[model samples]
Target: MCQEQKGFTLWFTGLPCSGKSAVADRVAEILRSRNLKVERLDGDIVRKSLCRDLGFSREHRNENIRRVTFVAKLLTRNGVAVLTSFISPYREIRDEARREIGEFIEVYVKCPLEVCMARDVKGMYQKAIKGEIKEFTGISDPYEEPLQPELVLETDKETLEESAQKVINCLKKLGYLDHNF
Candidate 1:
C-alpha cells in the first residue's frame, strides 16, 4: 500500500555455500511475518525444476539468471517482493537483471573461498576439488565479485540474523519499507 512496501526484487549473489540462501530465508521470513507478499527463488531449487537441462557453464548460468530475473520482474510487477539467491557470478548478467527489474536491490554475500569450502555442508566444494563436479563456481569455474552492490554481508564474520537485518535495514533506508506498514 505504501511506497516502501510496493514491490521489489532482492537479489542475493555469492559463492555456492556462501550463506546467500541462509540470509535470504531469514529475510523472507521476516518480511512474511509482516504479512507482506513475498517469494524466494532459490538457485538449487530452480536448477532442479526450472532449468534442469542447463549445465554449470557460464552461458548456462547466465541464462538461468535471466530466467530468474524474468520471473522476479513479473512478480514484482504484480506487487510481490521477490527474494532470489543464486551464484550469479557474473557482474554483466546481474547488471542485466538490474536493468530489467527497475526496483532491484543487489546483496553481495561476501565470504572467503576458504570459509565457503569449510562451511560447505553438502561437501560440494570437496567434490568439486576432487573433480567429481565440473564447472563449479570458485573451484573449477570463476565467480566475478560484484563491483558495486546495495549491500555487502560478510557472512563469514556476521551472524545470519545480522546479515538479514542488514538487508532489512537497507530496504528501510532506501524507502523500500513503508514506515506506516
Candidate 2:
C-alpha cells in the first residue's frame, strides 16, 4: 500500500472578482510562513499556461476543471498544500476532486453578482458586458455553485485578511497545519 502524505487541498470556487485568488494567495502565504509547502494554482494563471488554448465554452470549462483537479491530486500526493482557485461552476467536477484527492476542502467564496461585477479586477465582467467575451459565467453562462461546501466565505463584505484567517483557522482545526504559529 502507498503511504499517505501529510498534504491537503483547499479548493476555492467562486465567480470572477469574488476575491478567490486574493484570499487564496493570503492563505497560502500564511501556511508557508509556518513551514508548510504550498502550491497555488489559479484558473487564470493556468489558462495562460497549461490551458492557453481553452475557450469559454462549457466543454472547455469542464476540461479545465478536470485538468486542474488532476494536477491538484498530484501535488497533494507529493506533500504540497494545493490551493486551487477557480470558478469551477459544477458540482460534478467538485465531487470528482473530492474522490480523486482524499483531503479536499471546498470553499465557496460567495459574493453577490453585482459586487463581483463592480470589482471586476481583471475587467472580465466589462468585456462580457460589452459582448466581447462569450460564455462568461454569471453573464453569458452559468456558474452552478457547490451544493454544500466545507466553507462559504462572503467576500463582498469580508476583508481578504479575514477570509484568509478563516481558511487558516479551518486548516489548523483540521490538523492540516501542525500548529498555527
Candidate 3:
C-alpha cells in the first residue's frame, strides 16, 4: 500500500534578486521528481495575475501576502506541497501566515543587498536607485529578516544545487519527506 505525502508550505523570503525564486524552483523540481504534488507561487508571476492591482506600499504588500497565504493554506490542507517565493518583508505578516497555515516552513534566502543588486537582470535595483521606482525593498522599503526561520539558504555563498539540497535536507529532517526522498 502507498502512503500519502503530508502537505506543507515552504515559504521562500528575501530581497529582490536574492535567488528566492530560483531556489524555490529547483526545490519544487526535486519534490515533483519524488512524485509529490507541488505548486509554486512566485512573486513576479503572482503579481502579474493575482496581485496585479496591488502596489508596493506596505498595505498592498501585506494584502498580497494575505492572498497568497490563503491560497497556500488551502493547498496545504489538500495535500499539495506549496512552494512560495515572495519578498514578504515583514515578520508580522510572515508570522501570521505561519499561524494560518499550520504546516509552514520559512526558508530565508539570505544574500547581501550588494550581491542582490549585482544579480539583478531586470534593472529593478537601478530603477529604484534612480528614483524611477518607489517602495522597493532593500532600496526604499525595508526587508525585515526572519528572526528564526526554519531554513536559511545563503545564495551568495552556496551554489544553487547546494541550496536546493539544503531545503530538501531540511524537509527530511522535519519529517516532511520520506527517508527515501
Candidate 4:
C-alpha cells in the first residue's frame, strides 16, 4: 500500500548570512530524496520576484512576510512541504505566520551577529553598518529572537550537516516525517 505524506512548513528565520538558506536547502534535498514534494521559498529569490516592489522598511518587511505566509499556507494545506528562508526579524510577524499556516515549524537559525557579519560575502553587514543600507536586521534594525522556536540551529557552532539533521529529526519527532526516513 502507498503511504500518503502530510505537508508541513519549515520556516527558517535568522540574520543575514546565518546559514538559513543553506540549511533549508539541505533539508529540502533530504525531503525530496525521500520522495516528498518540496517547495523552497527563499528571501533572495522571492524578493527578485514576488516581493520585488517591497523595500526594507518595517512595513515593507511585514508585507513581504505576509505575502510569503499566504503562499506557504496554500502549499502546506495542499499537502506540499514548503521550506522558507527569510530573516523574518519580528516575533509578531513570525507568530502571525504560525497562526496562518497550521503546520508551521519555526527554525531559529541562531548565529552570533559577529559571526554572521564574518560570513557575509556580499558585504551586506558592512553596508548596513556604514549606514548605506538602512533597516538591516542585526545592524541598523533589530532581529527579535524567537521566544519558543520549534528548533534552534546555532550555525556558528554546528556543522551544516548537523544543523540539517536536527531539523530532520525534529520533523520526524513531530510526526511530520516518517521515522523510517
Candidate 5:
C-alpha cells in the first residue's frame, strides 16, 4: 500500500479571464498524474452548486470564500490536495482562508485588465462596463491584489505548462510532493 501524503490547498486568485482556472486545472492534472487525491473548487461551478443563493455583494463573496475554505480545510486534513480557483477579490477573505486552511499556497495569477478584457470569452467584462453586471470585480467593483502571495504567475507572459510547472516546483520545494518531481 502507498504511504499517505500530506495535503495542501493551492489557492489561485486573479481578475476574470486572468488564467486562474486554467492554471489550477493544469496543476490538478499534474498532481493527479502523480497519484495525489485532488479536489478543485472552481468559483463558477461552486457558485452554481454550493452557493446558489449567494450574490455578488461583499458579504456573499466572503461567504463563498468561507465555504470553499471550510471544504478545503476538511480535504487537506484528510490527505486530499485542494485547488481553489476564485477571483477572491478581497485580501482579508484570502487571509482568512489562509488562516482557516493551515497549509495554503496563494498563487496570484497576474494579467493586465486590458489583456483580461480581450481574453474575456464570456463578455462579462464588457457587460460590467455597460453596467449590466453590478459588483463585478475589476470593472464595477474592486480587486485587491494579494500583498504577499506565495507565488506570482504572470499568465500573460508564461505558457500554461510553465505556470503549472512553477506550481509543481513550489509544491516539491515545500515538501508537499516527492523531490523526484
Candidate 6:
C-alpha cells in the first residue's frame, strides 16, 4: 500500500451548540485552501440521511456515531481528511470509532453548557426548554467528555480561525503534514 494512503480523521465531539460543527467547517475550509483533500461529515447532515427517523435515545446516538465512524474510515482510507462533527456524547462510542478508524484524532470542543446555550445559533436550547425536543444533549442527556483527547479545543475562548490553526499545528507535529506533500 502507498504510505500516503493513511489519511486522517479529525473527530470533533461536543454539545449541540458547542461550536463543534462551526470549528470543523473552518478547519475543513483552511485545509482545502492548502490543496489538502478534506471532507466534513456532520451529524445533522448524516442523521438526515442514514439516521433520519432515529430518536434522541442513547441507543440511537450510539448508532449514529457508528455510522459516521464507518464513513470516516472509508474516507480516510481513500486519502481524504475526514472531519466529523458529532455530539458523540459517550466516551465508549468515541473510543469505538478511534479503535475502528485507527488514524482518528479526537478534538474536544470544550465549552460549558451555559456558554453553548448562549451561543445557540439554532435556538435548540430554547426549544428544548419548551419541551419541543426531548432528551436534548447537555440538558436531558449527558455528554461524556473525552479523558485524553489528542487535541482539546476550548472553542468558547477562541475564534474559529485560531481553533483551526490549533488543529493544523497538531497535524504538523504528528508528522502527518509536509510542505511538499
Which whole-number lDDT from 0 to 100 does residue 129 have in model 6? 84
Candidate 5, residues 1-181, lDDT tens digits: the string is: 9789898999999999999999999999988897789999999899999999999899999999999999999999999999999999999999999998999999999999999999996899989998988998888889999999999999899999999999999988888888996
The lDDT, on a scale of 0 to 1, for candidate 2 is 0.88
lDDT of 3 at 62: 95
Model 6 lDDT tens row, 1-181:
6356349999999888888888899988888887788999998898889889787798988988888889889989899989999989999989999999999899999988899889888899999988898998888888898999999888788888888888888888777777443
TM-score of 4: 0.98
Best candidate, TM-score? 3
Clashing pairs in 6: none
TM-score to true structure, per model: 0.96, 0.93, 0.98, 0.98, 0.98, 0.94
160: Cα error in model 5, Å? 0.9
Candidate 3 C-alpha lDDT tens digits along 35-85 = 899999999899999999999889999999999999999999999999999
- Candidate number of the best lDDT: 3
In order of listing, the candidates' clash counts read: 1, 0, 0, 0, 0, 0
Q: Candidate 6, TM-score vs. the true structure? A: 0.94
Q: Write the per-residue lDDT of candidate 4 for residues 1-181, one digit (tens) a residue.
A: 8876788999999999999999999999998888899999999999999999999999999999999999999999989999999999999999999999999999999999899999886889889888999888988888999999999999989999999999999998999987888
In candidate 6, stretches whose alpha carbon ends up further than 4 angstroms from where it belongs are 1-5, 179-181
Please identify model 1 stretches exceeding 4 Å from their true place: 1-4
Q: Which ten residues in a row have the lowest lDDT in candidate 3?
A: 172-181
lDDT values for all models: 0.92, 0.88, 0.95, 0.94, 0.93, 0.88
Better of 4 and 5 by lDDT: 4
lDDT of 2 at 10: 95
Error of 1 at 173 (Å): 0.6
TM-score winner between candidates 1 and 6: 1
